[model samples]
Target: MNGLHLIAELHDCKCAPRLLRSVDALRELCLTICAAPGLTPVGQVFHQFGSAKAPAGATGAVILAESHLAVHTWPELNAVTLDLYVCNFSQDNSVAARSACARLIDAFIPERVEQREIVRGSCPK
Candidate 1:
Protein backbone atom coordinates (compact mmCIF):
# COMPACT_ATOMS: atom_id res chain seq x y z
CA MET A 1 0.00 0.00 0.00
CA ASN A 2 1.68 3.24 -1.06
CA GLY A 3 1.18 5.80 1.68
CA LEU A 4 2.50 8.83 3.50
CA HIS A 5 3.16 8.88 7.20
CA LEU A 6 3.73 12.06 9.20
CA ILE A 7 5.24 12.13 12.66
CA ALA A 8 5.63 15.10 14.95
CA GLU A 9 6.81 15.76 18.48
CA LEU A 10 5.47 18.94 20.03
CA HIS A 11 7.64 20.27 22.84
CA ASP A 12 6.49 22.87 25.36
CA CYS A 13 3.06 23.31 23.80
CA LYS A 14 1.78 26.85 24.40
CA CYS A 15 -1.91 26.04 23.96
CA ALA A 16 -4.41 26.11 26.79
CA PRO A 17 -3.66 23.70 29.64
CA ARG A 18 -7.15 22.32 29.36
CA LEU A 19 -6.44 21.20 25.79
CA LEU A 20 -3.54 19.14 27.03
CA ARG A 21 -5.53 17.34 29.72
CA SER A 22 -9.04 17.10 28.42
CA VAL A 23 -9.92 13.95 26.51
CA ASP A 24 -13.02 15.55 25.10
CA ALA A 25 -11.02 18.45 23.78
CA LEU A 26 -8.37 16.24 22.22
CA ARG A 27 -10.92 13.92 20.65
CA GLU A 28 -12.85 16.80 19.20
CA LEU A 29 -9.73 18.37 17.77
CA CYS A 30 -8.58 15.16 16.13
CA LEU A 31 -11.93 14.51 14.55
CA THR A 32 -12.33 18.06 13.38
CA ILE A 33 -8.92 18.11 11.71
CA CYS A 34 -9.76 14.97 9.78
CA ALA A 35 -12.84 16.63 8.36
CA ALA A 36 -11.13 19.87 7.39
CA PRO A 37 -8.67 17.95 5.22
CA GLY A 38 -11.41 15.71 3.78
CA LEU A 39 -10.18 12.54 5.46
CA THR A 40 -12.82 9.92 6.08
CA PRO A 41 -13.34 8.93 9.69
CA VAL A 42 -14.76 5.45 10.02
CA GLY A 43 -14.38 5.17 13.80
CA GLN A 44 -12.59 6.65 16.82
CA VAL A 45 -11.54 6.12 20.43
CA PHE A 46 -10.05 8.46 23.06
CA HIS A 47 -9.04 7.87 26.66
CA GLN A 48 -8.07 10.06 29.59
CA PHE A 49 -5.08 8.94 31.61
CA GLY A 50 -5.85 10.03 35.15
CA SER A 51 -8.50 11.45 37.43
CA ALA A 52 -10.06 14.77 36.54
CA LYS A 53 -8.53 16.68 39.45
CA ALA A 54 -5.04 15.33 38.84
CA PRO A 55 -5.17 14.41 35.21
CA ALA A 56 -2.18 13.01 33.40
CA GLY A 57 -3.06 13.45 29.72
CA ALA A 58 -4.87 11.65 26.87
CA THR A 59 -4.38 9.11 24.13
CA GLY A 60 -6.60 8.41 21.15
CA ALA A 61 -6.82 6.99 17.65
CA VAL A 62 -9.10 7.98 14.79
CA ILE A 63 -9.36 5.17 12.30
CA LEU A 64 -9.82 6.65 8.85
CA ALA A 65 -10.92 5.20 5.55
CA GLU A 66 -7.65 6.33 4.04
CA SER A 67 -5.63 5.34 7.13
CA HIS A 68 -5.40 6.55 10.75
CA LEU A 69 -4.53 9.39 13.08
CA ALA A 70 -3.19 8.86 16.59
CA VAL A 71 -2.33 11.36 19.31
CA HIS A 72 -0.69 11.06 22.72
CA THR A 73 -0.49 13.97 25.13
CA TRP A 74 1.63 14.52 28.22
CA PRO A 75 0.13 17.38 30.14
CA GLU A 76 2.73 17.27 32.90
CA LEU A 77 5.47 17.89 30.37
CA ASN A 78 3.41 20.14 28.12
CA ALA A 79 4.19 17.82 25.24
CA VAL A 80 2.39 15.89 22.52
CA THR A 81 3.19 13.36 19.81
CA LEU A 82 1.18 12.94 16.60
CA ASP A 83 1.08 10.25 13.94
CA LEU A 84 -0.93 10.50 10.73
CA TYR A 85 -0.87 8.06 7.84
CA VAL A 86 -2.88 7.90 4.66
CA CYS A 87 -2.72 5.07 2.16
CA ASN A 88 -2.81 6.00 -1.50
CA PHE A 89 -4.52 2.91 -2.75
CA SER A 90 -7.21 4.61 -4.80
CA GLN A 91 -5.70 8.08 -4.93
CA ASP A 92 -2.68 9.93 -3.61
CA ASN A 93 -3.48 11.20 -0.16
CA SER A 94 -0.20 12.79 0.80
CA VAL A 95 -1.42 16.38 0.57
CA ALA A 96 -4.46 15.69 2.68
CA ALA A 97 -2.34 13.90 5.26
CA ARG A 98 0.10 16.77 5.44
CA SER A 99 -2.72 19.25 5.75
CA ALA A 100 -4.26 17.30 8.61
CA CYS A 101 -0.90 16.98 10.35
CA ALA A 102 -0.25 20.67 9.99
CA ARG A 103 -3.61 21.46 11.53
CA LEU A 104 -2.76 19.37 14.56
CA ILE A 105 0.60 21.03 15.00
CA ASP A 106 -1.01 24.42 14.66
CA ALA A 107 -3.51 23.60 17.36
CA PHE A 108 -0.78 22.63 19.82
CA ILE A 109 1.28 25.73 19.12
CA PRO A 110 4.44 24.22 20.56
CA GLU A 111 7.60 26.19 21.16
CA ARG A 112 9.55 23.57 19.21
CA VAL A 113 8.47 20.92 16.74
CA GLU A 114 10.28 17.79 15.60
CA GLN A 115 8.92 16.39 12.38
CA ARG A 116 9.58 13.45 10.06
CA GLU A 117 8.11 12.03 6.89
CA ILE A 118 8.20 8.35 5.99
CA VAL A 119 7.33 6.98 2.57
CA ARG A 120 5.62 3.62 2.86
CA GLY A 121 5.34 0.78 0.33
CA SER A 122 6.68 2.78 -2.58
CA CYS A 123 8.88 0.07 -4.03
CA PRO A 124 7.60 -1.54 -7.18
CA LYS A 125 6.02 -4.89 -6.45
Candidate 2:
Protein backbone atom coordinates (compact mmCIF):
# COMPACT_ATOMS: atom_id res chain seq x y z
CA MET A 1 0.00 0.00 0.00
CA ASN A 2 1.32 3.43 -0.93
CA GLY A 3 -1.58 5.83 -0.89
CA LEU A 4 -2.61 8.94 1.04
CA HIS A 5 -5.89 10.39 2.29
CA LEU A 6 -6.38 13.90 3.52
CA ILE A 7 -9.38 15.25 5.48
CA ALA A 8 -9.94 18.90 6.12
CA GLU A 9 -12.67 20.98 7.72
CA LEU A 10 -12.58 24.60 6.70
CA HIS A 11 -14.33 27.15 8.87
CA ASP A 12 -15.35 30.70 8.09
CA CYS A 13 -14.54 30.68 4.41
CA LYS A 14 -15.17 34.03 2.83
CA CYS A 15 -16.30 32.67 -0.50
CA ALA A 16 -18.63 30.20 1.14
CA PRO A 17 -20.73 33.21 2.02
CA ARG A 18 -21.01 34.04 -1.66
CA LEU A 19 -19.98 31.34 -4.15
CA LEU A 20 -19.91 27.90 -2.57
CA ARG A 21 -23.65 27.90 -2.07
CA SER A 22 -23.95 26.81 -5.68
CA VAL A 23 -23.08 23.33 -6.84
CA ASP A 24 -21.06 24.63 -9.77
CA ALA A 25 -18.19 25.80 -7.57
CA LEU A 26 -18.17 22.55 -5.66
CA ARG A 27 -18.03 20.52 -8.84
CA GLU A 28 -15.26 22.67 -10.24
CA LEU A 29 -13.17 22.27 -7.12
CA CYS A 30 -13.51 18.49 -7.23
CA LEU A 31 -12.45 18.39 -10.88
CA THR A 32 -9.45 20.55 -10.19
CA ILE A 33 -8.34 18.23 -7.40
CA CYS A 34 -8.85 15.19 -9.58
CA ALA A 35 -6.55 16.67 -12.21
CA ALA A 36 -3.74 17.06 -9.71
CA PRO A 37 -0.43 15.35 -10.42
CA GLY A 38 -0.25 11.56 -10.24
CA LEU A 39 -4.00 11.11 -10.04
CA THR A 40 -6.48 9.93 -12.64
CA PRO A 41 -10.16 10.76 -12.59
CA VAL A 42 -12.49 8.08 -13.86
CA GLY A 43 -15.86 9.69 -13.14
CA GLN A 44 -17.71 12.29 -11.08
CA VAL A 45 -21.12 13.06 -9.54
CA PHE A 46 -22.39 16.25 -7.94
CA HIS A 47 -25.70 17.20 -6.34
CA GLN A 48 -27.00 20.63 -5.50
CA PHE A 49 -29.34 20.87 -2.52
CA GLY A 50 -31.74 23.66 -1.60
CA SER A 51 -30.25 25.90 -4.26
CA ALA A 52 -33.56 27.67 -4.74
CA LYS A 53 -34.70 27.51 -1.13
CA ALA A 54 -34.02 29.40 2.05
CA PRO A 55 -30.70 27.59 2.70
CA ALA A 56 -28.29 26.04 0.23
CA GLY A 57 -25.41 23.55 0.02
CA ALA A 58 -23.49 21.39 -2.42
CA THR A 59 -22.27 17.82 -2.30
CA GLY A 60 -19.88 16.32 -4.83
CA ALA A 61 -17.74 13.27 -5.33
CA VAL A 62 -15.04 12.56 -7.89
CA ILE A 63 -14.14 8.99 -8.64
CA LEU A 64 -10.47 8.37 -9.31
CA ALA A 65 -8.42 5.45 -10.46
CA GLU A 66 -6.87 5.28 -7.03
CA SER A 67 -9.99 5.98 -4.95
CA HIS A 68 -12.16 9.10 -4.52
CA LEU A 69 -12.41 12.70 -3.42
CA ALA A 70 -15.53 14.14 -1.80
CA VAL A 71 -16.72 17.50 -0.58
CA HIS A 72 -19.73 18.90 1.33
CA THR A 73 -20.49 22.56 1.82
CA TRP A 74 -22.71 24.54 4.18
CA PRO A 75 -22.80 28.01 2.77
CA GLU A 76 -24.97 29.46 5.48
CA LEU A 77 -22.34 28.58 8.04
CA ASN A 78 -19.50 29.59 5.75
CA ALA A 79 -17.88 26.17 6.00
CA VAL A 80 -16.72 23.33 3.83
CA THR A 81 -15.69 19.80 4.67
CA LEU A 82 -13.50 17.83 2.27
CA ASP A 83 -12.06 14.37 1.87
CA LEU A 84 -9.32 13.34 -0.58
CA TYR A 85 -8.36 9.70 -0.82
CA VAL A 86 -5.93 8.18 -3.30
CA CYS A 87 -4.49 4.70 -3.50
CA ASN A 88 -1.14 3.75 -4.98
CA PHE A 89 -1.36 0.62 -7.06
CA SER A 90 1.84 0.97 -9.09
CA GLN A 91 3.60 3.77 -7.22
CA ASP A 92 3.26 6.11 -4.26
CA ASN A 93 0.67 8.87 -4.68
CA SER A 94 1.15 10.77 -1.41
CA VAL A 95 2.66 13.88 -2.97
CA ALA A 96 -0.16 14.17 -5.45
CA ALA A 97 -2.72 14.01 -2.68
CA ARG A 98 -1.05 16.80 -0.78
CA SER A 99 -0.80 19.01 -3.83
CA ALA A 100 -4.46 18.56 -4.57
CA CYS A 101 -5.49 19.25 -1.00
CA ALA A 102 -3.54 22.49 -1.02
CA ARG A 103 -5.26 23.65 -4.17
CA LEU A 104 -8.70 23.05 -2.68
CA ILE A 105 -7.82 24.79 0.55
CA ASP A 106 -6.48 27.79 -1.30
CA ALA A 107 -9.74 28.11 -3.15
CA PHE A 108 -11.80 28.41 0.03
CA ILE A 109 -9.41 30.60 2.03
CA PRO A 110 -10.78 29.60 5.39
CA GLU A 111 -10.19 31.61 8.50
CA ARG A 112 -9.77 28.48 10.62
CA VAL A 113 -9.03 24.88 9.75
CA GLU A 114 -8.87 21.34 11.02
CA GLN A 115 -6.72 19.15 8.79
CA ARG A 116 -5.29 15.65 8.85
CA GLU A 117 -3.18 13.54 6.52
CA ILE A 118 -3.50 9.79 6.87
CA VAL A 119 -1.62 6.88 5.35
CA ARG A 120 -4.33 4.90 3.61
CA GLY A 121 -3.66 1.27 2.71
CA SER A 122 0.00 2.23 2.96
CA CYS A 123 0.66 1.18 6.52
CA PRO A 124 1.94 -2.33 7.00
CA LYS A 125 0.60 -3.97 10.10
Query: Candidate 2: misplaced stretches above 4 Å?
Result: 16-18, 53-55, 122-125
- Model 2: how far residue 40 lies from native, Å: 1.3
Point to the candidate with the largest lDDT: 1
lDDT by residue for model 2 (1-125), tens? 56788999999997645457778777876786668576788899988888466438888898988788999988878899999988777767778888888888888999999999887554544
lDDT of 1 at 87: 97
Worst 10 residues of 2 by lDDT: 116-125
Look at candidate 2 and tell me the lDDT of residue 55. Answer: 39
Please give the lDDT score at residue 57 for candidate 2. Answer: 87
The residue pairs in collision within model 1 are none
lDDT of predicted model 1 = 0.94
**How close to the true structure is residue 23 of candidate 2, measured as C-alpha lDDT?**
81
Give each model's whole-structure lDDT: 0.94, 0.82
lDDT string for model 1 (1-125, tens) is 89999999999999998889999999999999999979999999999999978888999999999999999999899999999999999888899999999999999999999999999997445
Candidates in order, TM-scores: namely 0.96, 0.88
Any idea what lDDT model 2 has? 0.82
